[model samples]
Target chain A: MTNSQNNSSVVDPRGPKPRKIMSRRNIILYGTLLVVAIYYLIPLYVMIVTSLKGMPEIRLGNIFSPPVEVTFEPWIKAWAQACTGLNCDGLSRGFWNSVKITIPSVFVSIAIASINGYALANWRFKGANLFFTILIFGAFIPYQIMIYPLVILLRDLGIYTKLPGLILIHSIFGMPILTLLFRNYFTTIPEELFKAARVDGAKFWGIYFRVMMPMSLPIFVVAIIMQVTGIWNDFLFGVIYTKPDTYPMTVQLNNIVNSVQGVKEYNVNMAATLLTGLVPLTVYFVSGKLFVKGITAGAVKG
Target chain B: MNSIEINNLSLNFGDVKVLKDLNLSVNKGEFLVLLGASGCGKSTLLNCIAGLLEINDGQIYINNQNVTWFEPSERGIGMVFQSYALYPQMSVKGNLSFSLKNAKLSKDEIEKRVKHASEILQIESLLDRKPAALSGGQRQRVAIGRALVRDVEVFLFDEPLSNLDAKLRTELRVEIKRLHQKLDNTMIYVTHDQIEAMTLADRIAIMRDGLIQQLDTPKIIYSNPVNKYVAGFIGSPGMNFLKGKILQDGKPIFKLEGGWCESPDLSNYKFQETIKVEKEVWLGIRPESVVVGGEAENMPVNFNLEIEVFEPMGADTLVWSQIGGQEFRFMVDVNTSINVGGTLTVGFDPAHASIFDLESEERL
Candidate 1:
């Protein structure tokens, strides 16, 4: 009995002599993660150092150099006004436009995606598999292929080159990926929960609106990051579909940096680039918490 | 008070039929377990009851209200998923209150219910933390809390305890049992693990190849299994089978290949009336029923054997040896001083053994 008790104590978590040892593989795993961390930090280091330098200082171009003149002017110039066109309004105008596009696009597209993904994953119907087939197939099609048709369609609506138009375009193009991400996420969720909801008198829309949508916030963040990045940095559709007045930050940034006559504004360009990346970057950072939470909560139980 | 009833239910995924005319009724407030091996359509059957999967042809009624065409949420059930499926963005309180929020209940009422649920699940301290902050068992409790907060009549658990470690599984199993006892709600649980079914369900339904092979109380499943499949599936180490023959003298005798004699009483059975045995039979014996080494003449059904292999478990030691033309295993006292190739008389108890028609594989 004493031996049994000793064995139980050793096997049990609270007692001494933890049986689980970090294997040799774990050391290699940590070493690999450390290497990856160094790789990921390299570009950010360059960006920060580059952002600190003036045009003349930038020309010297030692990637590791600490700027002799640590000035915030580039960041400021990118924010307030750098000449995108004759209208000296800087990256901020496009930044606001990106916000306008990303907000509606992310929410609308993600909402639709979660609903569609849930249906495809959990619900059954005759054409459901076909719908999934079409959607997955739609995801592989190049983004450029749909541009002409989409631009024409928006132009016919007369809301073309407007904020809503850009938002709509972003949503339409983003549907496949957003739906796909949510679908894969929801697939890992056991079917019993849906059935329990069904037996609880949860209708299709009821479960989707209440249980599934609420349970899908991680995929939502993932969708936000994807859509924000894709739509925020978009130039082709933004240029063709929107007027000069409504151009997003990417288009404006391009016009400023790409133009030969416009005096090259390196500091402003870098600042604008950082600003353009900021919303999606911020979204990724903020939503990353939820993403981590979702896996623990919704995907893995043990 | 919701009782789910399925009639003539069959579901096919593409060309493969996963469920075939499954007919079963789970009474109100009863805990029903669908136990089977993986790919046996137990989960599929549970989904059909939950109204998550559409039956190819059948009717599903919840509390006598036909809900074959109803949506999942409208089916009046609360389910716990194996993955937990807790809303990550929501706090434990938020996750618990979400369904109530969707039900458009007043905020105060939602809070009251969420509070009660958290208390019931013993997760009140972790209500404010996101799922990321909680341990696996805690997350599982929150999942149960989420299900409990929604006042559904039928509870569905799709292998909810599968993700838990063995110790945590035992802990949560007791908690689930307590919850069931308190709520007295109809619950349909699906698991590939028979032990879970045996410990939890009021009645365990065994499924094989999309059909329910046997449905009975745990005791009956353990002792009075209808076929070899049920007999093998329900018990740890399972029941053993040996080739035997029914004699003309109304005696069922098990023939041994390596010079062994075993017998189990078949005088009360009607196997001969159903199918002619023609001297071919299968004798089934559970390990615990058989004893090892004693006076050979005193034993009713005794066989001489050489212990070929032995496995020691603290309480009991398993003695495995070749008997008849097949391998046979028997459990004995752990202190049994037996070694490989040692000669000893193995005793078989006649009363606890079962006889089956060899060709049909059906218990007689």
Candidate 2:
């Protein structure tokens, strides 16, 4: 607590002395935060560095050290030709598979969840709350517990161990939270708005498409972020549902990096890991602005 | 045919009966204001008329059509909500024209209606701005404009100006009244504010406990409330009541505090035909009706009382004093110089007073 007289810093005209950026308190505060940030970022740094380095340089130097020789060979191999058991093609197969799975899964799950949320918020029928309670409670249970039952059900439908089966699994697992997210967000909307819309001649689907959906873009973006990241990085359901050919990117990435028959090309594995994470990472960065704030700020009179 | 009609309307929220056997009718182009305290079912009744709430037992007819089972839109009505439910993502013009657009109206027709509404509301400049960009009063104007574009037979409002500040509320209140005058549609407005009710309504329905306690013109409801509750509720600084007994004699005098005040001429008063002597009653008088100082000399009943407290309001002053061992409030002109401890003669004429029965509370 340096007094204004003791330091060569500008004193605030409002009387209280403001902390200077170079003050001891700010130094320690920002210094500690920077340390924590770097601590979290160290692994990402290592991944990037490892992905760029040739194997010879990686072996010659420490993992944290700058590479003597950099190469895109590992990235090329990871993207096109890394082997996974009988397959020579690499993470690209799983990449495309994930795109196919994640796109439909995100769209279908959000579409159903937003509509479900709107209905639960505005329209009530017998047993709606009962089923909603069950759905929310279902979110808390471990996904592993339902895997076997889901497998049998998918099998009965003759879609087990297929891409559609994986898509169905993602939607089912994502429902509880997504529905709850949408329902709670939709509830905050003034009930009068719904009434006004109805009096303005909006029907159920009409209100949903015209009123609720446009008004809920922020929540939709949040839901998409959750579903994209959740389904993209999903390893458990992918392994459980789809075979190797149709396996999602995470499953194929895991198989490629952990394959036991060859030498552990560490650089290639890092490259493949970063490649697999690229989709969700891109989504997060692109929507990162709307993700934090201002989506629903002026939507209602505060 | 009446513009809107309700037959045997009853609504229940589970076991709680919110509205009971309510029946009402409105003439075309009449502005009806339902005035009540919170949870008095005034808003519920408006919702029922708007087809927003399902009545457990009732038939609602609009324009001679039994629209009880029809969807709200099909009933040819538009409703404005308390929250000013403008579609946030839409501009003022968009919010006004959304339903028209949804109805697949032609582009020129939709644009024409929107322009007309904007011009009517004096919001022509705010057309391109979103609701979030407009001030609260402007947003409400757009909300009204939304309903105005529909050209419906009936317009329902549920405390549309409650969210604004007091100054803005008064401004919007006058604007809404003007809207009603210009549109000449059957408007059913619900509000807890007596000023809004009194100023805008052609007929005000005062409700309590899910029933319309009194329905009449504002002047009548003010001058002659139907019951003790109606008298107590309709005014600010509400009506003061003094408990006394009416002694039926040669001239029929109201006996209180060993003094006999002349009974009001009741020939025009509507009540039970039977008159009883030694019957207990309560005399109600509005704050403004209680004459003070030199004014009391002209009234039928006059008394000298000490002012307990003097509150100087800007335009007028409210003086509180005790009369017959009961606290009474009376209004005086701001220019009337008065102190808390000063004595002033106060009086009220019986014709301007309401007398209610002690047992039934019905006016006599």
Candidate 3:
């Protein structure tokens, strides 16, 4: 009993040893991470501080400093009174326009792309490989090259410079990458599951809605985050595709900042930029965990 | 009456033929097992019958109706898969009812069928549990219940118990057998495990290289396999084969190639055709058929050979030895005193052995 007690009392040396709190490796790793984080965070800090300050205070020009007298005037003006073109109304209209474009575009693109992905992954119709190859190839082409042709096509169709036209463009442009993502994700699901669904009397739409759709919530969240951010922050497409009245938030913000006629109120510009960025930020934070889960879901076997 | 029939079925994947000219007829209320190694097209054949694959050429008839062009849902058959393909997002009840709801069955009918299936599968308490929450065996039971709720006339199982542990596999095997006896539906099961095939099947169709080698009752397949491949495949620890030649003396006798012991008599062995003198042949003897100790004294073919290895497997022990310079194995009771390097007398009745032609490998 004494020998057993002595043996039990002795510390085992087989496991990991205790190390200093500030080891060199940890210091290097954490210090590098902290530095990189601050590098990305400092611009966001400046934008927040600048957006809260008045024009005179911003003119003093210490962007790194916190606001001495925090005010909501610039935000209110940015939301209701900033002039983009002839309209003196603010980013609120642009925000609504962005919302309209994003909601429909995200839904429409996801709907079409998910079906296309399901067909490509599960169904073996003729020429499917060719169709998938063409779709994936479209993802690699620069958007700038397609813009002129699309403009001409939309003009001929008589929907040019309209929200519907812009919505159509965003939906079409989002398809190739979104379809590829969904296809790869669907492929990760067991083929037996698809076969079982088929045997269970679920046809194409039935399986898609009931079985595939329910199991694909993570991918849907990922797709929503992707499309919302892409369409909301789009400046080139929004400017070229729609009139100033229907301009998305990104285009309206550009017009407010670089009007080339009035004294550029930097605070109002910063406030408009912050306001324009808020939608995508809110979406990311709301579904951030799901987005990560979606990305890594296909990496491991279920 | 035939419940499922395949006429000249053929499937190709690009340039490679996966299944070639396959024809099968499953009887009503019969349990037929498609047994083969991986890539032998057993699961592929099951898939074809289920209408899950578009066959390159075939006519599949179910319940006297041609279902070659019909959708899987229209074929009146339900299938279970190796992965227990229950909808991971839904509860067991939802999984069982999803297809019924699609079929537009009345709410009361759907509930009644779901209750009946869950009761039969003993998963009534797991109705609200998702597949992810259940253990593997429970999930598989739910999968079977999903198929059962459809009230299909035929059930196809594709290695359904493969994903479970050995103990669970045995338990579920009995459950599946019990389910079949209760349902009395035409069932086509695909498995690589011979023990499962033997125990559960009314008839076993052993396949190799996209062709059916033999389709017979398990006893016939075990005792008189049609080919060398069937003989080699059906038994655990496998049948022992000795390369020899059949010499026609006053009576038929098998001469071992290495001539290590006295030749065994083949007078009592049944031949499929007239035997040729001095023809190359393979003599196959099942390990358990070879008797040891005092039991060997009464046998026609008896020999004493030194044991090289012994594996004690509870009730029986498998002893490996060399006869005629070729490895020979036999099973003895575990209580028997057998050790490596000990000489032991072992013998088998020639009637129980199989003789195969050397070049054709066909039973002779």
Candidate 4:
């Protein structure tokens, strides 16, 4: 080729042209994302708006509109005065019951499951795989099918309709999945670290507490979020295992929203629904970053 | 007295044997390296000594006490891993002191050990920094520091320098050698890198297929490998092997397979056993042992070969050539001018060469 022609044909390396804001790819991608976001946000918006409105405003029945006059009376009533079953003391008692159930259940299940995971991941005594297989199999079993058996079991143990009974039930049901999560997460940590711990004169419990536990903050955050949300939002186990006196907030919420004794106060129902969800929501917000990291770390390996 | 002894150690993973009938003994204050290719069970042997792996059949002794059934911690050993294996969440100080605290040492003792270890490792300034914040070399130094604080009589290193870059690996290899000298403790280091084994080891156990092919000082292993496998595994450019047969008249003479050149005189060669008759053998000549140009004139066995390629490796140039249609290599000065397709005279004394029997592949 001629020198001038060769030089002219050689194009300088340049980046792709920037696409316009309204390109088809951008439109489709952001459109689907916006629709999905709005789909979830609309219900949350309606609940928030409905909870802020007074009874007369809620009666006007424009659910999407902002309240003409904001009132927190429904919230106060949901917390104190509103009746749940025979008690007119509102969800305060049930909230405390949930606190009692959730805190211990989360801690106990995590403590046991984390140790189970560490053993399964690092130390392979005989039958460890069999034990892990059974634990994982437990995770896949339908919770509904076990309710009757669990009720009988708890009743025989003389903890039926008690806070401790519900706590025990939550702890047991939370074990299999939490253990699986912890096992997968612990497996992602380099095996050499475990070996090094063993060589450094750290025995089983020492290694677990000092090495594995310290390095596993993200996974622990993940477990806490899972157990807190699962135990707090549970309606079936709480209702089945506890009586009205010790009913968790979720069960009490069902009583308030589904009661047939009086006028259905929409604002009070929304306020109580929001209050019931507040604990888990706060947990997710607080540990959202680590939640994503822990999930990806566990999923990518083991 | 021996610091660590392993007897009849055999470990199996189901049907696959990872280590088979392995026996090793390390002298007190000696630095022994287990050198091998990957999957050769070098690291597995180190783990067995550390009590990290339970042997299927064997006994391990540390400082004259049988520790076969002891817990890893109870075995009184410290280990560094290839991945450095530092506690990512803890500061360098915490990493050093965690096990000391776990052992229930007094706070003053723990602090004293940590300070001593960090100072010796030249990581005193990094004491408060977490592993994630440190560089690779710094992190590895901290890992070594962790082992140092244990004050164990035996230290196990499972390829601790394998993860570092080439420059860092050389730097850390020297540091490890220096550390061994300063601490005067028995160390068992496992690595696939031959150079590290050669430089850092007082003696190297060259392993293959879960068995140690040779165990001797680095100089002895280099100059007089017990078998062909070790002779081939130890050197960087690798020793050149010529397929030949040894015929005995009055003295042994190695006949080239293709009769490409005159048979090399082997009268001066040392034999492990007396040669009975004509036998198939491999004549191994290390690249550095093969003198080229004018120096080839005085050698016991000398020949001219056509050079096919040359590689300049900065310090020395490796010249690739052929002998009896087999590939052969020799090292020459980097400044030596070389051209492919040119004839070059190369020679090696059989005394410096290793001859292995063709059937058993054992050194003669």
- Which candidate's DockQ is highest? 3
What are the per-residue Cα lDDT tens digits for candidate 4 across A146-168?
Answer: 99998899889999998888888
Could you tell me the TM-score of chain B in model 1? 0.93
Minimum summed lDDT over a 10-residue window in model 3 chain B is located at: B259-268
Compute DockQ for each candidate against the true complex: 0.31, 0.68, 0.80, 0.72
Runs of candidate 4 with Cα error greater than 4 angstroms are: A1-24, B248-251, B276-278
- The residue-by-residue lDDT of candidate 4 on B1-364, one tens digit each, is 9999889999998999999998988899999999999999998888888888888998899999999999888887988988989988888888899788778999999989998998888899989998899999999899888888988999888889888899999988888888889889999999999999989999999999999899999999999999899999989799999998898767788888987767888898888788867789999999988888899988887888888999999989999988878899999988777898988888889888999989899999
**Docking category of candidate 1:** acceptable
Q: Please say which candidate is ahead in DockQ: 2 or 3.
A: 3
For model 3, how does the per-residue alpha-carbon lDDT over B134-229 read when each residue is reduced to its tens digit?
999999999899889999889999999999999999999999999999999999999999999999999999999889999999999999999899
Q: In model 1, what lDDT does residue A18 have?
A: 45
Give interface RMSD for all predictions: 3.8, 1.0, 0.8, 1.1
Give the best candidate by TM-score. Answer: 3
**Which tens-of-lDDT digit does each residue in B48-125 have in candidate 2?**
888888889989999999999988888889888888999888888888988897688999999999988888989999
TM agreement with the true structure for every prediction: 0.74, 0.92, 0.96, 0.93
Q: In DockQ, how does model 3 score against the reference complex? A: 0.80
Worst 10 residues of 4 chain A by lDDT: A10-19
* Residue B129 alpha-carbon offset, candidate 1, angstroms: 6.1
Worst 10 residues of 1 chain A by lDDT: A293-302
List residue ranges in candidate 3 displaced over 4 A: A1-9, A12-21, A298-302
Candidate order by decreasing DockQ? 3, 4, 2, 1
